[model samples]
Each structure stands twice: as C-alpha cells, then as structure tokens.
Target: ARWSPSGDRIAFVSNSGEGSEIYVYWNTSNTTSKLTQLENGPSSISWSPDGKHIAFTMKVNAKAPVIASMPAKPKGAKWAKPPRITDRLKHEADGAGYLKPGFNHIFVISSEGGTPRQITTGNFNHGGNISWSSDSKNLVYSGNRNENWEYDFRNSELYSSNINTKEITALTDRNGPDYASKVSPDGKHIAYLGYEDKVQTYQLTQLQLMKSNGENKKVLSNKLDRSINTAIWASDSKGMYISFDDKGKTKIAFIDLAGNISDIVENVGGTTLGRPYASGSFSVSNSGKIAYTYSRPDRPADIAMVTKKNKKPIVITAVNDDLINYRTMGEMEEVWYKSSVDGRDIQGWIVYPPNYDSNKKYPLLVENHGGPILNYGNRFSTEIQLYAAAGYIVFYPNPRGSTSYGEEFGNLLYNNYPGEDYNDVMDGVDTLLKRGVTSEDKLYVTGGSAGGIMTAWIIGKNSRFEAAVVAKPVMNWISKTLVADNYYGYANSRYPGQPWENFENYWKFSPISLVGNVETPTMVMVGMNDLRTPPSEAKQLYHALKLRKIETVLVEIPEASHGIASRPSNLITKVAHTLAWFEKFK
Candidate 1:
C-alpha cells in the first residue's frame, strides 16, 4: 500500500474477494473508487510523480485449461485428468506451487482506470525495488535478466524502463545482486543495496550510490559490518538512513555520501506478528518525520512516530491493548552470557512462569528458532508467552549465525552450523540453571527447521534434556540437499561443493549420523505438505531413533506447509500438542 505523490489520495490492493483489485481513496471527497481489477495481485506498487499512472509487476501468460480426449459414458461421465508437463529446475515453491510457463513483467495503468500497458517483456521475472523518476518519464526496478536466472538465484541487475518509449536499459553490471533502488529526493542519484558475489552462505549488503544514469558507483556503507536492509533518502538528499540488525536488536542508522555512518534509533522491530523473531520496517517522510512499527515485550507492533533524536516515540495505535490489558502476562528478562565453547557473547531472553516466585524452580522449555539466520528479540511472542503461562520457564537465545548481529556473528556457522551453536544453547541453559530459575531434572527442548536441526543435534550430543521435539528438521543433509526445493542455491552457498564432492563433510553435519548416542524420548513434528524441509527428513530420524531403541513419536500436521502455524487453529493445535507432550513426560 502507498499514498499517491500528491498525498490527496491513497492507492492500495485488496484480495478480499475472488480476485485482487486496486482501489483509490480520495481524502477531499471522502469517497472510495476501484481503479482496476486484476486476475492476480500485483506487487511493488509504484505511483508516478505526476499521479497519473501506477506501475507494478504482475504474472503474465496465464495457463489455459489442459484439454484431454475422452469418451462420454451414459449420463455420468468421468474423464481422465490431463498430465502436467514440467521443464523448469525451480518449478515449485512453498505457499505457491507448480510454477507456470510465465514471467513477472512490469505493467502500467492510468490512475483513474484504463487498459494496462506492458512495459517490459522477457523470459525472466522482474520485481522489487521499484521506483518512479521524479519526472514520471521512467521507472526503475531490479530483476535477473541474465540467462540461467533460475539456476543463479542471486544474480540480479537494476534496470530502468521508459514510461512512454517502453525501452529498457541496464543500470548496474555486477556478479552479485544489486536491488532496492530508491531515487534520491533531487532525482540526481540512486541509493540501493548490493554485495560482491563470493558464493559464500553469508555476505554483507553494502549501501551503494550511483548517478541517475547508473554511473560513478560507490559504496557508501563499506565500513558497516552488518547487512543493510533498505535505505530512505534524507530530505536533503545529502545522505540516506538504513535499518540493520546488530547483535539481537534492530537499529536504524544513517550513511552519508562520504561513507560516514551514525546511529539514529535502537529497538526498531515488531513487524513479525507470530514469534519474537527479528522483523520491522520504517518510512521517513519528506518533512523529517519517521513512522515505524514499534516493538516491545508487553505488546505486539504499534504505530509510532519520531521527529527528533533522543526523544521518546509517540505511539499512535493500540491495536492489541484491548486483549493485552486484560491478560496477566509473564515477565521477560534479557540474558547475556558467554558461549561455553569459544567464550563468545550470546544474547538471549527468558520468560518467567506466570505468577512466579523466585524460590520456586520451574521446568525449563528452551525454544529454538528456525532460519538459524533469524534471531529472536524483545518483542511480544504468543508461543513463548503461552509456554511461560503453562507453569514453565521459557528460554530463547540468539546464538552464532543469528542476524541482527554483525556479519562475523552471522557467519559463525556458515559451514559449521549446529556445531558451536549447540554449545551456545547449552550455555544459555546453564546460565538459567545457575540463576536458580529452572529445574535441572525436568529440562525440555524444541525447535523448527534449523532450530529442529539443533534440537536433534543437542539430544544426540548430551542427554541433559529429558524430552525433545524437533519440528521440520533435516536429519540427513545429503538427502535434504538433493530433495529440497532450493537445492541448487542451498547446496552451493551453504556448503563447499555438491553432495558427492563433499560427502564426508555432509555426513559429519547430519544429525542422523549421531543417532546411536540418543537416549532422550524425542518427538518429531512436521507439516505434511512442507517442501522446504520435507517430512521424509523427520521420518528418517524417527526410524533411526526407533532402531536404536529410543522412544520416539512422529506428529505430522495435515494440509500444512513449511509454516505449521500459518492458520490460527493450527497455531493453537501446535502449542497444545507440544505442551501436552511435555506434560506427559513431566
């Protein structure tokens, strides 16, 4: 959703009905109007400077119904289904399945309503970092136009298309991706984020500067060690402000044309509605006011704004207060301790049981986050709070390889994940025990995706935790790299070489390889329809543990994808089942 250039109207998309439609609301007239109807929703909406047209990316070449020859029966006829012919390497994706033979092309239509015009056409898809020139004559966006784009997911370049002539020109030529173009206020320069292609699992995205014509490119944030998210140019056009995660918190910073940097605000998060994971965004207006989703431990995201430094943000919305005010929430405290393995500082948070007493020891329930790249921060989390509410002390940590931290921390597990990271979690657990908060004999651990990988690895390494639940984990790295939807990119960037080239290394990292030492009663959970970390990974571990005489149970959520808690009912079920398993063991 975006406000028009003139600020007199707002343009947004709605998918409430059978199809997605674009609508515009007039502030003066106090009336709403539908601009256009689309077969599929478009993304990255860019309103022209003159407020005459809007540019967006939409999928082209809609597939026609597959026809089959069949003989009709008496009255009730049954026809054979048409066979699907697939020829793409990256054919299917989570949430969206079965990639059709089409491309995401840029299109433009009048603000009032008219026939949409196709601006760019090719085999490759174009989206993200879309912006219109101040003159409204051209629109710039980022896309991978290079050949073998599907194979090389990270090779994308910036391109600009003439609104009238429909001619497209490449703006940046580099091995790595350069995207998220934001035209400066004066329209003389473009600020975007990019990095050199080292083919490593992690790399810092440097904030770059280039002339309007895409010349004199220079990296304005070369000194910053963390990856820059996005930049919104200052009203003066002298420098730009960028948001990045450092350690366990998200901070907003400024980068000048001379490569100098400074911090603006800290604790800029709360966009992630589900878990207390790292996520947030901010937008700066031309008048120097900054609006962002503010995060806190007691509540979810609330709209807040700031106009000056060192001043408290004025929260303008109380969307969750109606329910939060009536609930008795648990207390969340920040924990900082050194990793037991290498003495690296690990940031974590512990939620005390509701109506807790310091003298009483509660059972510890350590929750591990997925991504292994994503980090948990000081935000409202339903799952963690629910655990604490059930008379259990919940612990979540941002170990090595967690983002919001600098590049060095995030790359700690580049090729050595589930290695020292296991030590980090154990150290966090030890810290809680030392603090006299949790009982040592009734420890429980659970995690999803990469977190699931760590949970399995932890149980294999040590039996301190009495019960374990690993959700959607990759028990065997060799099989995971071959069958996962993003095998090409994951296998190459995450590891040194192909599965056969680095067979020993792959085996060394697989949790199934160490299943012989398991003694803890473990439960394996996965979404039945998950493609990212397939259920087969869970079955392999379950079977391996069973063969070793280890008590194990497999819990598969039907009709669910990689995200098991995508629906409200599923979230309730996942929490209820996990808590039930822990109660049974207790």
Candidate 2:
C-alpha cells in the first residue's frame, strides 16, 4: 500500500487465476480494478509520489519455443499434426527453455489502467529489488553491460534513467563488481555495495554511498570485517540499514552519512532450511518497520516482522506448520571441527534421520554444495531433507572456500581447491565418528557441480565410502573448458594458466586423472542438456568405471541443465534415485 502524497491507497499485485495483475484499492472510493492485461506477468510495483502512475517490472513471453522433429509417427491410424519448432534452444534448456523469451526491466503503466510502456532495453539482464525516486521522475536499476558481458560476471554497475526523457546515465565506475543500488527517500543520495578486484577466490564487497548523479563515491563500512548483503535507505534519508555476517552469524546494522556503524540486531536472520550458515533478507517499510525472512534449525525460511519498539520479532509466515504436522523431518545441528591439514576450524551441519535414536547406527551421506564458493547456510532445501527423511544421516560442511567467513579463510582454495578442503571433509567425518553419531562402515557420499567433482575425487583417493554418486561433475578440466557455458571466462579465472600453458596443473587437480584408483561402487548422474558441466564429463566417468568392470550406473536427467533438480518433480526424482542408490549398498 502506498501513502498518498499525504499518505492512503496501497497498490499491490495480485494473481486472480488468469495471471498476476496490479490493483490499487483507494482509501476514499473503497474500490479497485485491473490496471494491466499483460500476458506474461508483472512484479516489483512502486507508486509515483503524485499517485498518477505506477511503475513495475513485466516479464513478457515474446516467442514460442522450437522443437526438433522426432522419428516418423509410429503406425498411427490417425494422429494430430505436429507443430513447427520456433525456438532454436528450446530442447536444450531444462525448465528455463520453457519460459518465454524476455528480460526484466522497468515499465510504466497509468495507475488508473491502460497499456504499459517498456522503459529499459538491451541484451543485459536487470537485477531485482528496484526502487523509484521520491518525485517518481526516474527509476534506478543494476546490471552488468560490459563489453564481454557473458564473461564479466562481477562487473554489475548502477544506472538511472529519466522517466519521460529516457536519458540513461552511468552511476559508478569501479574496477570490481557493484550492485544492490537503492535511492534514499529524499532522492539525494544512493547506497550500494562495492569491492575492489583482488584476483582472490571471492570478492569482498563493502558498503558504499554516493550522490544521486554518481559523484563523490565513498565507502561507509570499510573498517568492518564483513561483506554487506543488502542495504536499505532510512525513512529520514540520513542513514541506512545494512545486513552482513560475522563468525557465521548474520547481523542487521545501521550506518549513518558520516560512516558510523552500529549493530541493531545480532544473530537475527536465518531461514529454516539446511544447516544455518547466515542466511536472511530484510525489507523496511516507510514507517521503519522491518520485515525479514527468518528460519530455525527445524523449519524453512518464513516471513518475520520487527520494529524498534518491540525488541523481539514476530513470525509473519508459517509455511512449515502443515508439512510438519503430517511428517517429521530430521532436525539440523551445527558442528565445528579443526581441519587435520591446517588446524583451521571448519564449520558444518548434520541432519539426523527422522525419529533418530542413539542406540541404532545409521548410514551417513556426506553431501557437498555447489559454487564451491556459495555457503550451505540454514535455508530451506528439499533435497537434503528428503535424504534425512529417507533414513540417512546427511552431512554438509562449509569447507575452506565457503562464504560467510572472512576473505582470508574463503580464499584458501582459490586456485587450489579439492586439496586441503578434502582433508577438511575427512576431519569432519572423523569428528562425527568420535562423537558416535556416524559409522565409518555405512558411509556414502554425493554432491553436484563442484561438489560432484569433489565426490569423484573422494572415491578415487579413499575406499572408505561404500557407495558414491557424483552429479553434473567436471571430470576432465581440459574437455570441460570447451564444453561448459561461459567456459573461457570460468577457466581463465579458476586456473593460473590456459589449457595449453599449464596442461599438467589442470591434470593434477582434475578428478578424472585419479579415476583409475576408484573402487567404490559409484553412480553418475547429470542433466543431458547441462551446459555448465555437460554430459560428456559424466560420460567420461561412466566409461572409466565400465572399463574397470566396476559396479556403476549412469542416470541422465532428460531436458535438464546444470541445475538438474530445479523442477519439483525432478527434485523429487533426484532425491529418490540418490536414496535408492545408497539403499542398495545398505
């Protein structure tokens, strides 16, 4: 709801079975009506100060997908004619291909109702969390429009355009990445996160501020030893609220124009999902009330509301209540251990089987996360829960390269991954065994993407695991670089030299090099159309296992991409097959 210039009608987007439409309920008229007839959908709606028009982001499906012709119709007496394929890359995409062709950008529609006008254009994709100027004369957005767009993943910049004139202007120019730009309520200053490129494993982003015209840029919380998650401009426009993590816990902080920082809430934001690694998001109302995503050890992330007057937060969304009533899922507990290689403390989480008992021993499934850079924080994850509910103890750890920790700790595996981090996982397993929570005899391991790569590496180096499943892994670095999407850029950044310059280095770190020593009964899974890891990587491992006459199976998820388990049905099947493979050995 938007406060009239004086403050009254709240305009909101509602789905009425047809599709998502915008509706403005007036305070005086006590009436409402549809403002748009968009075929796709619209979201991120904001009001103009004068209440004359509403600006929103619309997703339009511009073209129908193309399909490849299959074998001639099989001996059918009568059959419906086949449709022509219009999209070239339709079948190649898992779920994303089915989506309409379009990019998210600003669109202005009369608050009363009419046709909506698209404002921003180009091939560059716009970032979310958009905001409007106080006067509603302009709109601000974040996107990376570098010359090498596909390869430049960390070069997003802030931009602003006139509502009527459509004059676009670049806000900030930094060597590193910048994003999450928010305009102050007064429309005088902009707040965003920026970081310098250090060629390290992960970029350390700092809170930064500048004038609306992108002048006089300065860092606000440079002294703080944490990366800013997101920031919101205060109501008075004098300061802003920021979120960051320290010691594996998330905290909400307030920063003033003078660069002073104060912690408002500590250990507050964590959505109920996997092990808690610091995960949550907050949105502040004009009145200073903060609504955020909250989670606990046993639940997934839900909406929570917080105010300065009430020191405690109130739960706003209870999504897991019904699910929990029908079936009990395993609860997660945070576990920490010192790495055997460096003595550095490593953090991980353990999810025991549902209705767990200490007297009975259970099989352990060590799951690795993707990104190798992304943290497996406490967030709602269906795959992990499904494994736990299937009577397997799941273990997920934030090895040396995981985020939430400081830069020094995260960069430990920049160019050197699957190295000491391997020891980190082994040490975690030993710690659980020492605590009598897991047995070495009934151990299995699995992971996807980078985690999948590690799984292949683990089975090659050790015979401790009885069974293993590696999903969408990069078996050979030399072939992976040419096959994967954004191949040139990712390969250049992760490795010190090109494939020709340092052939031995790539072979030294690749898991496929050690496939000859693998003895564990392994199962390989991957999306048939995955561009990131590609199917050939999985094929290499499958062929090697078959050549050795070892017990192995290769399951290819059809019409899926790098993220094989994106769809609800695919996720269910992914978990079921993984559990079935492990159950065979058990």
Best by the TM-score measure: 1
> Which ten contiguous residues of candidate 2 have the minimum total lDDT?
86-95
How many residue pairs clash (N, CA or C atoms closer than 3 angstroms) in each of the candidate models, in the order given?
Answer: 3, 19
Question: Which residue runs does candidate 2 get wrong by more than 4 Å?
Answer: 1-45, 56-95, 98-106, 115-129, 144-153, 245-250, 258-280, 325-329
How good is model 2 by TM-score? 0.83
Models 1 onward score TM values of: 0.95, 0.83
* Clash pairs detected, candidate 1: 245-404, 246-404, 247-405
lDDT for 380 in candidate 2 is: 51
1-586 in candidate 2: lDDT tens per residue? 4444544676778897598888777778788777788876787777777677787777644555545656666785567776744432222333353344656677888877889888888766665556677788888877766766555666778888788987778887766777777888888998888787766667678988898888999998877767888888888998888888765567777788998887766545544233334677887888888887775656667777776556476887888788766878788788989998878989888888889998888889999877787777554566777888888888989888877787777778867867888888888888988888778898999999989988998998999998999999999988887656545555546778777787887888889999999999999999987888889999999999999998999999988888787676777778888889999998
For candidate 1, give the lDDT. Answer: 0.86
